[model samples]
Structure formats: C-alpha cells, structure tokens
Target chain A: MNAIVTVLRKEVRDTLRDRRAVLSSLAGALFGPALFAVFMNFTVERTIDEGEAAIEIPVVNAADAPNLVGYLGQHLIEAKEAAFDSREELRASVRRGETEVGLVIDKQFGTALGEGKAARVWIVADRANASAQTAVARVRGALRSYSSLVGVLRLQLRGVDPGVARPLAILNDDVSTPSGRSVLLLGAFTYFLLFACFLGGLHVAVDSTAGERERGSLEPLLTLPVSRGALVAGKFAATAFFMAVALIIGIAAFAVAVDYLPLAEVSMDADLGLVECAMAFAVLVPIAVLGAGLLNAVTAFTKSFKEAQSYSGIAMLLPTLPILLIILNPMQPTISMMLVPSLSQHLLITSIVKAESIDPLYFAVSATSTVAIGALFGLLAVWRYRSEKLLV
Target chain B: MIEAEGLTKRFGDVVAMDDVSFRADDGRVTGLVGPNGAGKSTTLRVLCTVIKADSGRARVDGVDVAARPLDVRRQIGALPHLSGLYPNLSARENIAYYAEMQGMPRREAGRATRTVIDRLGIGDLSDRRAKGFSHGQSIRVALARALVHRPQTVILDEPTNGLDVVATRALRDVILDLRRDGRCVLFSSHVMQEVAMLCDELLIISEGRVAISGTPDEILRETGCGDLEDAFVAAISSERESK
Candidate 1:
C-alpha cells in the first residue's frame, strides 16, 4: 500500500509534466458539458422563439378564400397573398424555406361553398420541413374549425339540433412531469458523463504503461522489489484519482452550463444542482475505477505509445454501448440491470435526473458489482504486469 | 556476494544463456567480458529477476532468485541494459522514486537522493529534466537510482558502453568506491581495456557460456596471450573450436 502511494505520486508527477496530457485531459472534462449546453440552449431557444411567432400561410388566390382567410386570421395565423409565376414556382418557394406553406384554391371553390357542396383546397408544403409541418397543422386546424361551424349552421337551417351531430365528447389527460419526459436527454447526459470518466485516465494510463515500455523504462521499474500487484494497484489508484477529478470537473461544468440553458422554455425541468452533481460523482466512482483498470490492462499489452493510443481509442467507445442498447431496446430498469457496471451507472444517473428516488438495494448492488468487476480488471492488470512477456 | 549456477535461458530455438555460472565476491569488482550476443545482458536480466531463467538457480546474498526473487531484489541494485529514466522528471525525482519504491519513506528517500546526487557530482544536472540530459548525465541518473538503496550487491549491464573517457573514469571510480564499501560489484563490458583496468576478477563469456573465469593476469597466463584482449580472443576461440 505504501508502495502503491509512492507509485501513484510518481505517475501523477510524470504525467502532469506532459503538457499534451494535461491539456487533453482538461479538454475531455469540458467536452461533454460544453456541447450539451450549446445544444440545449440552441434547441430550447429556437423552440420557444418558433412557438411565439405567428404562423404564416400563403394563399395563391386570396379572393376565393376570403372567409377561410378571415377564420385563419382570427386564429392568430397570418394569411397572406402569395405571388408566383406558376404552381411549380410556388412549390419551389415553400421548399426553399421562403414560405412555410402554400394554399391553392380551385377556381370553382366559391361556387362549391355557395351550393353547400365540398370545396377543394390543396395544402402545399414539404412534410419533412419542421416549420412547414407546424404551419400546415395550423392551417388544417383553422380549416377544420371553419368546416365545423358551417356544418352547425347548416344543421340549424335544416331544423335539427346541432348538439345531436356529436353524441360523445372526448378529452385526454396527460400526467407526465417535465422531468419524466426528459429521460432521453438525461440518459444522453449520463452517457457523456460516464464517457468522460473513462477518457480522463486514458492518456495517463497509457503513458505510465506502454509509454514507459516504449521509452525503455518498464524493465527497470519491474526489477524493483515492489510486487507486481502493488505496482498495478498504484497505477490504478493514480488513474482512478485523475479520472474522478476529471469527472467531477465535467459534472461541475455541466451543472454551471445547464444553469444558463432555457430548459424551462421547452418544459424540461432538469436543473443539475450541487446535490445532483454530488450524486453523479458518488455513483460514477466505481466506473471511474473500472475505466482506469480497463485502460491500464489494455495498454499494458501494447508495445508502444501509438499502439496503446489506438487501443484506448477503441476502448473509449465501450461506455456508449450500453446507452445505445438502452435506446434501441428501451426497457424499464430491473434489479438485474443494476448488476452490470456501466449499464447500472447509466440507469442510476438517468433515474437521478428524473428526480426519482432509487432503491438503495439497487444502488448497493450496482455500486458493489461495478467495483467488484473493476477490482477484477485491476487484478488482471496485475497479472499482466507480473508476466515475463511484459519485460519483452 | 552474488552467484549463479547452471543458468540457461532460451528465446525460441536460440539459446541466450546456456548453463552459465559465475560468482562475484563482496569487496571486489567482477567484470563480465564478452563479444556481442554473448548473453551478458540475458545473464544480468535473470540475476535482476526481471526475466526468469528456464533452468537454473541464482542467488544474491544466499537468497534464491527464483524462489525468493523479491528477497533477491531487495538485496541487489541492478542497472539493466537500458538506461530507463523518466524523461519528464528531474534526475533527483527519478532517483528518489526508486528509493521510495525500495520502501523508504519520502523524507528518507529525499535524503538518500541528496546523498546520491552529491556522491555522483550531478548536483548541476540533478534538478533538470532528463529529456535534455547528455548520455553521461542520463547514465549517471540511472546509476544513482540503482545505488540509492545501498543494496548488498550491485549489477550493471554495459555501464560504460557509450561513455566518454571522463565519464568512464568516473564510473570506474564509483565501482572502486562500492568495492571499498564492501559491496559486491558485477558489471559487464565489451571494452577489453576497461575490463582489464577495473576487474579484480573476470568472466569471459562466449556463445552463452563462460569461456574463462579468473583474474585478468591469470587468464593472460593461461592463454599465453600478450594482454587481456589476446587472452579474451584466445579463450573464446578455444571454446568455439571445442564446441
């Protein structure tokens, strides 16, 4: 244990002196949170701005749809005359994002409405365009209200009760809280957090192991009186320490950055506070250890700095696997999911974000199992260090 | 004292060391002389307990290397074929790390580091990062690390392989100082004049076997050679002919 501390200090000192390693580690910590903030701010702000803006519907023949335009105007949708040389030109305008939707009323539309017959109006817009789709919905809604009113008036004129036209009234009750609805975003957030933990120690672990080998230092180091297990443990401690620090920094940055995000505009009530950050740090401890151990174990097999770097590059993608699985096959958390290390941490972090009180038993199982697996990898690293092939 | 008996090591089909055995007594400098690929490095590595021999028993201060390798390591300070220094750390830090690895407390390691730095006359270079160190400076740091623990036996592989005359003389003086302090010093060199100048005893290895082992004068008389170089060639050539 004393030897482990010694080695840890030495590893830290050596790696910290490397400016590239220091700068890269710091960048890893800041990457996830800074990106999340930018995405959230842009999306939430755009959604809010788009929601408050008036819906613009461009009609080719404004005279033919006077009543319909008036009805749409009453519904706060702006009905405007559209100018185009041809039908294709109008369609091109909508596709070019110059107009949200275009309306083309038949020449006989007034004749049809006067005779109490069907009227044909085509709503032209790209369904794939988000703003166009929303504008099309608003236009359809206004048309439906106008159509319903006309039907009521026609029924009264026929000396029948208009209420008899609809015998049933339907309503929907939605009970999902904003927190409950933002689970996907929170899951993604947790994924990046765990990823940061894995990457924080990557360079250091590779530097201390394979980098040492490439520099011709491992042989002398191994020849010391220290036990291979102790040496590995020491390296693991340094890696985990740096990883935890990096993870904490990432969480703090995320928390601070999230404060300026307009999540309330989008009705997402996620506020990553101090308590949440602390919980994230606590839950991620085992994964950080596991990540460090895994990196060390893999890099110890590599013969050079470049080989170790490529290997660790592959390892960085491992944390995201469980998150991807969760997305592809979404499932409610069971006790069994908590037994898998990264998966369990993901589930726990997601639950934390949802403001749901997790089962202590689940947290215990997750923490203990993850740490146990990490310790197993640490032992494997020790075994690798002990091998004679390590010297070669 | 350090001893190896019937030590054999192989890499695939090639034998690195074949039944090599020798002893270096305390208070004397034992020079391991060999041509290239004579297994001097392999033998030192096995003795350092970094690489295991296929079949043999090696000991430092009577502790078996294979069975009690940690104990053997504790008794020996080994400078392997590589000058393994952390380029980012200062010389003092590199040496101090080894002292701490040997189980010394931080303060004690610091003290020992100071003593080793002073003894090596590397005070000017000790605080600078090893990346910019000259070859002699780097070797001095590695040597400081090896001797920081003050082990019972010192083992070095080609300690003077690339050193200039001044650095070589300094290294020889350190070896003599170790002998004066009653420590067993075992080092390998291909330079015949170096071996002739410093070795109280010599082990000339050829084809992974000890071609001859005795004092330099004794080997010269035995081969009826002009000097240590002729004796070394005669010894290895005779061993090669017999094989």
Candidate 2:
C-alpha cells in the first residue's frame, strides 16, 4: 500500500512538471464546455429568430393580382415586384438561391375569380433548400387561407352556412415538458464529459508504461524490492486521479456554461445547476477507473512511447463507443444497460439534465460493474508486467 | 555473493545462455569479458531477477532468484545496458523515488538520496532536471539511483559503454569503493583494457559459454600467452575448436 502511494505521488509530480502534458490533459475539459455553449447558443438563437421575423418574396406579375398581394401583406409576408418579365426568370432565380421563394400569378386570375372558377398560381421554391422550407410553408398557408375565405363568401352569397364546408377541426396538444425537450440537445454534453475523462489519463498511462520502457527505466524499476502488482496498482491509481480531476472540471464548466445559453428563449430548460453538476460528477466519475485501466492495458502492449500514443488514441475511443451507440439509437434506461460503463453514465447524466428521478439501484450496479471491469484490466496490466518478455 | 549453476535460457530457436555457470565472492570485483552478443546481458538479467532462466538455478546473496524474486531483487542493484532517467524529474527525485521503492520512509529516502548524491560528489547535478543531461551525466545519475539502496550485490551490464576519460576514472573509483566496502561487484565489458585494470577475477565468455575463468596470471599461463589480450583471443579460439 505504501509503495503504491509512493509511486502515485512520484508519477503525479513528474507529470505536473511536464507543462505540455498537463496542458494537453486539461485542455479537453475546457474545450468540451466551450464548444457546447457556443453551438447550443447559436442554434437556439437562430430558431427563435426564425419564428418572429417577417419575410419578403418576389412576384412575377404584381398588377395581375393586387388583391392577393394585399391579403398576403396582412400575414406579414411582403410582396415585391419582380425585376424579371417572365415566370421562367423567377424560377431560375429561386433555383440559383438568389431568392428563397417566388410567386407567378396567371394573366386570367381576375377573370377566373369573377367566373367563380379555380385561379392558377405557382409558389416557386426549392424544397431541398432547408432555409427556404419555412418561407415556402408560410406563403402556401396565406394562399390557402385566401382561397378558403373566397369559398366562404361565395357560399354565404348563396344563403348556405360556411361552417358546413369544414365538417371537423383538428387540434394538436403537445405534452412534452421544457426540461424533457432539452434532453436530446444535452446528450451531446454527456459525450463531451466522457471524452474529457478519457483524455485526462492518457498522458499518465502512456508515460508510466511505454514511456518508462522507451526511456530504459522500466528494467531498473523492475529490479526494485517492490512487487510488480504494487507498482502497477500505483500507476493505475495515478491515472485514475488525473481522470477524476478532469471529470470534476468538465462538470463544473458545463454547469457554468449552460447558464449563458438562450434556453429560455426557446422554452427549453437545462437542469445544470450546482446540484445537477454534483450528480453528474457522481455518475461520470466511476468511468475514470475503467478509462485508466483500459489505457494502461493497451499501452503495455506497445514497445515505445509514440507507438503507445497511437494505440491509446484508439483505445480511448472504446468508452465513447457506447455513447455514440446510445445517441444514434436511443433506448430507455434499463437495469441491464446500467451494467455497461459509458452508456450508463450517459443515461444517468441525461436523466439529471432532464430533471427525472433516478433509481439508486441503477447507480449501484453501474458503479460496481464499471469498477469491476476496471480492476480486471488493472490485473491484466500487472500480469503483463510480471512477464519475462516485458524486459524485451 | 552471486552464484549460477548450469544456467541456460533460450528465445525460440536462439540460444542466449548455454549452460553458463560462475561465482563472484564478496569483497572482490568480477569482470565478465566477451565479444558482443556473448550472452553477458542475458546472464546479468537472470541474476538480477528481471528474467528467469529456462533450466538453471541462480542466487543473489543466497536467495533463489526464481523462487523468491522479490527477495533476490532486494539484495541486488542493477544497471541495465541502457540506463535511462526520467527527464521530467530532478536527479535527487529520481534517486529518492528508487529509495522509497526500496521500502524506505519518505524522510529516510530523502536522507539516503542526499547521501548518495554527496558520496558521488555530484551535488551540482542533483537539483537539475535530467532532460538536458549529457550521456556521461545520465550514467552518473543512474548509478547513484542504483546505489541509493545500498544492496549487498551490484550487477552492471556494460556500465562504461559511453564515457569520456574523466567520467571513466570517476566510475572506476566508485567500483573500487564498492570493493573496499566488501560488497560483491559483477560487471560485464567488451573492452579488454577495462577488465584488466580493475577486475580481481575474470571470466572470458564467447558464444554463450564461458571460454575460461581464473585470475589474470592463471589465464595468461593457461593460454601460454604473454599478454592478457592474446590470452583472451587464444582462449576463445580454443573453445571454438573444441566445439
């Protein structure tokens, strides 16, 4: 036990003295929260602005449909006279993305309305353009409303009830809460946290195993009086310490960064207060052991520091695999899923962000199973250290 | 004291050590001299308990290397062929780290570290990080790290591979001091002059087998050569002829 502590203290001091390693480890912690804040804020702001802003669309023959243009103005959709003389020109401009949406009124529109016949009009738009879809929908809705109003007037003139034209009315009632709606966006937040946790221990894990061997220090170290198991345990503990530190920093940064997002403008709530941050830290910290163990085990197989680094870069992605899988195919939290390491942490953290109740049994199973796998990896590292080929 | 009996190790089809046996007593410096790839390093590794022999028995200070490696390691201080130091740690911290691993308390390890640093007369180099140290400076610090525990047996695999005149003389003095303190010292070398100048007992190994071993005068008389270098060559040739 004493030897483990001694090795841990020495490794920590050694890594701290290396300015480059320390910076690389902690940089991930800050990067995740900063990106989360900037991206989410921009998205929310754009969505809110798109809803209330008025849009302007060009019309090919404004003189042919003055009354239709006047009716569109009431819905905050302004119509401007097109510079082009033909409908083809309007269609070309919309296709080239110079205009979001355009209108082409038929020459006989007024005569058709007088005869009580269906008028011809074209709403020219590129449906493939995501930005133009909203504009197209708004213009189409205004035209449909104008047609319905004309129908109602024509029926009233005949002494018929307009309500008879619409037999039933459909209404949408959404039951999702504001916090629950934010869970999908905040799923990315859990990914960042897990990535930072893995990155924190990468340097120490590579340094203690492959770095020592490359430096030719492992041979002399093995000749010491201490058991190989104690040595491995100490190195693993140091890696875990760095990983936990990164987890804490990431959680704290997210908690503060979430406050700056315009979530209220979009009617979304992120439960990232101090209490939630603490809960997230609790749920995510157990994965650090698994990360440290996995890194150490992978690095032990490599012969040099550079080789270890390349392998560890791939190894760190293992825990994040569960996060990606869960994101792509979201599943309800179950006790069986809680047995997986990163997936469980992601689920528990998502629940914390959504302000949902968590089962204590899930937490217990996740922590224990994750730690058990970590210990197994740790033992594998120790066993490798004991091999005669380690010196080679 | 160190002893090996019929020690043999093989890596697949390559035979590294072939029935090698030798003994180095306390209070004397024993030199294992051979050409390159003569299994000098492999033998030292086995004796230090860093590796095990496939079919042999080796002991350090009367402790079996295979049965209780930790006990064997406790009695020996080894300097491998490539002695490397942690670049981020100072010389003192590196030595103290080993001292602590040797089961010393924090305060005691610090004291031992300072004592070893002073004994080597490398006070100026103790406080600086090892990143920029030259080859000779690195070897000196590595030697200090090995000796901080004051083990009963010292094993070095080519300790003077790369050293200037002054550094070589300093290392020679340190080896003499170990002999004066009555600790068993076993070192390997490919250079004939180094072994002649310092070794009290010499073993000439060639092709994974000991060609000859005795006092310098005894080897010279046995090979019928006037000089130690000629005797070394003659013994190696005769061993090859016999094989």
Candidate 3:
C-alpha cells in the first residue's frame, strides 16, 4: 500500500507538471458549460423575438376579399398589395425569395359567394422556407375564422340556432414543469461531464504505461523490489484521482454557466444549484474510477505510446454511446438501467437536473457495479504487469 | 554470489540461451563477453529475474529466482544496456525512488541516495534533471540508482557500450569499488579490452552456449594464445568447429 502511494504520488506529480495534459483535460470542463450557456441564451432570445414578430403576406388582389383581409389585419398579418400581371409572377416572386408568402383571390369569388357556391382562395408559399410556412399557417387560420363568422351570420338570418353547429368542447391541461422540459438540455451537460471523467486520466494512463515502455523505464521499474500489484494500484489510484478532479470541475462549471441563463422565460429550468452539483459528483465518482482503470488496463497491453494513445482515443468514445442513445431516443429511467454504469450515472444526472429525488438503491447499485468493473480491469493490469512478456 | 545452472531459454524456435551455466563469487567482478547476438544480454536478464529461464535454477545470495523473484530482486541491482533514466526527474530523485521501491523508508532512502551520489562523485550533478545530463552523467545516475538499495549482487548489461575513454574509466572505478565493498558484480560486454582490464573472471558465450570460462590469464594459457583477444577468437572458433 505504501509503495502504491509512492508510485501514485510520482505519477500525479509527473502528469500535473505537464502543461499540455492539464490544459487539454480542463478544456472539456470549461468549454462544455460555456457552450451550454450560449445555446440556452440563443434559444431564450429567439423564443421571445418570435412571439413579438409580425408576419407579412403579399396579396395579389386586395379589393376582392376585404373581409378576409380585415380578419388578417386584426391578427397583425399585414396584407401588402402586390401588382403582378400573371399568377405565375406571384409564385415566381415567392420562389425567388422576394416574398415569404403570397395570396391570390379568385376573380369569381364574389359571384360564387353571392350564388351560395364555394369560392376558391389560394395561399402561395415556399414550404421549404420556415418563415413562409409560418406565414401560410397564419393566413389559413384567418381565412377559416372569416368563413366561420359568415356561416354563423347566415344561420342566424335563416332563423336557426347557430349553437347547433357546435358539438363538443376540448381542453388541454399540461402537467410538465419547466425543469421537466429541460432534460434534453441537461442531458447534453451530463454527456460532457461523463466525457470529462473518461478523458481526464487518458494522458497519464498512456504516459505511465506505454510511455514508460517506450522510454525503457518499464524494465527498470519492474525490477525494483515492489510488487507488480502495488505499482499498478498506485497508477490506477492516480489516474482515477485525476478523473474525479475533472468531473468535479466540469460539474462546477456547468452549475455556474447554467445558473447564469434566464431559462424561466422559456418555461425551462436547469436549476443547477449547489446540492444538485454535489449529488451529480457523488453519483459519477465510481464511473470516473471505472474509466481510469479500463483505460490503464488497455494501455498496458499496447507496445508503444502512440499505439496506446490511439487505443485510448477510441475508448474515450464509450461514454458518448449511452448519451447519444438517450438523446436520439429518450426513455424513462428504470431500475434496470442502474445496473449499467454509464447509463446509470446518466440517469442519475438527469434526475438531479430535473430536481427529482432518485432512489437510494439506484445509487448503491451504480457505485457497486462500476467499482466492481474497475477492480476487474485493475486486476487484469496487475496480471499483465507481472508477466515476463511485460518487459517486451 | 551469483549462480546459474543449465539455464535454457527459447523464443519460439530460436534458442536465446542453451544450457548456459556460470558462477561469480563475492568480492570479484565477472565479465560476460560475447559477440552480438550471443545471448549475453539474455543471460543477464535471466539472472536479474526480469525474465525466467525455461529450464534452469538460478540464485542470488542463495535465494532461487523463480521461487522467490521479489526476494531475488531485492538482492540484485540490475542495469540494462540503456540507462533508462527518467528525463524529468533529478538524479537524486531517481535514485531515491528506486531506494523506496526496495522497501526503504523515505528518510532512509534519502540517506542512501545521498551516500551513493557522493560515492560516485556525482554530488555536483545530482540535483540536475537528467534531460540535460551528458551520456556519462546519465550513466553515473543509473549506477547510483542501481546501488542505492545496497543489493548483494549487481548485474549490468553492456554498461560501457557507449562510454568514451574517460566515462569508461569512471565506470570501471565504480565496479571496482563495488568489489572492494564485497558485492558480486556481473556485467556483459563485447569489448574484449574492457573485459580484460576489469574482470577478475570471464564467461565467453557464442551461439547461445558458453565457449570459455576462466580468468583472462588462464584463458590465454589454456587456449595457447598470446593475448586475451586472440584467446577469445580461438575459443569461439574452436567451439564452432566442434559443433
């Protein structure tokens, strides 16, 4: 145990002194939170702007549908009269980005309405254009409202009850809170946190294992009187220590960045307070250990530092798989998910962000399973280091 | 004392060491001499307990290598062909690290590091990081690291392979000092002159087998040669002809 501590101290000192390793690990911690802040800021500002922005529609004929135009004006959709010699010009204008939406009223619309026959009105828009699509919805809604108003008046004039046309009333009651809707946003932050834990110890893992081999230090170090198990334990401890540090920093940065965003305006709240951040760190400690052990074990088998680095780069992507799966197809966290280490930590993290209290059993299962996996990898590393082939 | 009996090692079909056997007594310097690819390094590695012999019983100070490797490692100070110094660590730190690994307490390790550095006349360079050290300086640090734990047996593979005249002389003095302190020293070298100058005894290997084993003068007398160099060539050639 003392030997392990000594080796751990040496490894930690060596890696911390390397400016490049320290900076790269911190890059994820700082960048993830700052990116989340920027994204939330953009979404909130865009939502508020969209609510106040007016829709503009270009109409080919304004005199034919005075009532239809009056209804649109009341809804803040301005009908700009455009002079076009042909209907093709109106559609061409919409296609050429000259207008977001265009409307054409048939010339026989008044004659048809007076004869009690259906009249045709066409709304021209480029569906691929987002603004044009939104404008088309607004124009269609206004025309429907005007047509209903005229039908109600006609029913009243015919001495029939206008209420007979109405059949049923429907109501929408939403139970989801602002925090509940922010799970996707918070999931991204959690993904970054997990990445930090996985990659934080990578440089040290590769440096102490394959780097030592390439530098010819492995044979000398192995020849010392210390047990191979102690040496590996020390290295694993140092690696997990760094990984946990990165996790803490990542979570803290996320808390500060998330707290700065004005999410209440958009009915979303990340609510990354002190207690929540602490809970997240607590939940992920075992995952950090698992990541460090697995990486070190893999690197121990590699022949050279470059090869180890390439291998570890692929290993770092392991955490992303679970996060991507959840993002692409979200599922509710179940007790069974707690048995998988990364998935468990992710679910726990999401729960923390949503201000939901998680089951203590889930935390216990996550920690125990992850630590068991980490120990398995650590034992493999020790066995490898003990082999005669290790010197090769 | 260091002893190996019938040490045989093979890598797939190539025999690295075949029926190799030798002994180096306490308070004497034993030189392992052979041409390139003659299994000198392989024999040294087996003795150091870094690699096990497929079929052999080796011991350092009466402790069997295979049965008690850590105990054997504790009694042996091993130096490979390369110095294997950490470029980022100072000479004192490197020596102290090995001392600690040998189970010495931190304070005791510090004292041992200082003693070895002073004995090697490297006190001036002891605090400087190895990155900027000269080849000779790094070799001195490596030697200090090896002796820091006060091992009963010292095994160095090609310690003078790349040293210049002055560095070689310095290394020879250190090996002689180890002998004076009653420690068994076994080192490998291809340079006949180096083996002839410092070794109290010699083991010449050829084609993974021992071709000759004796003192320099004894080898010369037995081979009917004038000098140690001709005696080595004659012994190797005779061994080849017999095979």
TM-score, cand. 2: 0.97
Q: Candidate 1 regions off by >4 Å?
A: A85-88, A95-100, A157-159
TM-score of chain A of each: 0.94, 0.95, 0.91
What digit string (tens of lDDT, one per residue) describes model 1 on residues A284-380?
8888878887889888888899999999889878877987898889888999999988888888888888888889899999989988887888888
DockQ of each: 0.87, 0.84, 0.70
Residues A1-392, model 3: lDDT tens digits: 77998899888877877888999889866778888889878977877665557767777777787877888888888777766645688889888988777788888888877776777888888889985665678688878887878778878988988888866656898887789888866778778888777778888899999999998888888788788899899899999999999999998888888878888877888887788888989999998789878988999999999999999889888767887887788888888888787888888888888889989998999889989998998999999998887776
What tens-digit string does per-residue lDDT give for candidate 2 at B1-243? Answer: 999999999989888899999999999999999888889999998998888999989888888999999888878988888877999999999999999999999999999999999999989999999998988898899999999989889999899998899999999999999999999999999898999999999999988899999989899988899999999999888877987
Two-chain complex of model 3, DockQ on C-alpha atoms against the true structure: 0.70
TM-score of every prediction relative to native: 0.96, 0.97, 0.93
Candidate 1 lDDT over B1-243, as tens digits, reads 988999999999999999998999999999999999999999999999998999988988899889988888888998877798999999999999999999899999999999999998999998899999988888888999999999989999999979999998999999999999999999999999998999999999999999999998889889999899989999999989988
Please, what are the lDDT tens digits per residue for candidate 2 over residues A198-272? 889999999999999988999999999899999999999999999999999988889888888879788889868
Local error of candidate 3 at B176, Å? 1.8
Q: Clash pairs of candidate 1?
A: none
Best by DockQ: 1
List of clashing residue pairs for candidate 2: none
Q: Give residue A146's error in model 1 in angstroms.
A: 3.2
CAPRI rating of model 1: high
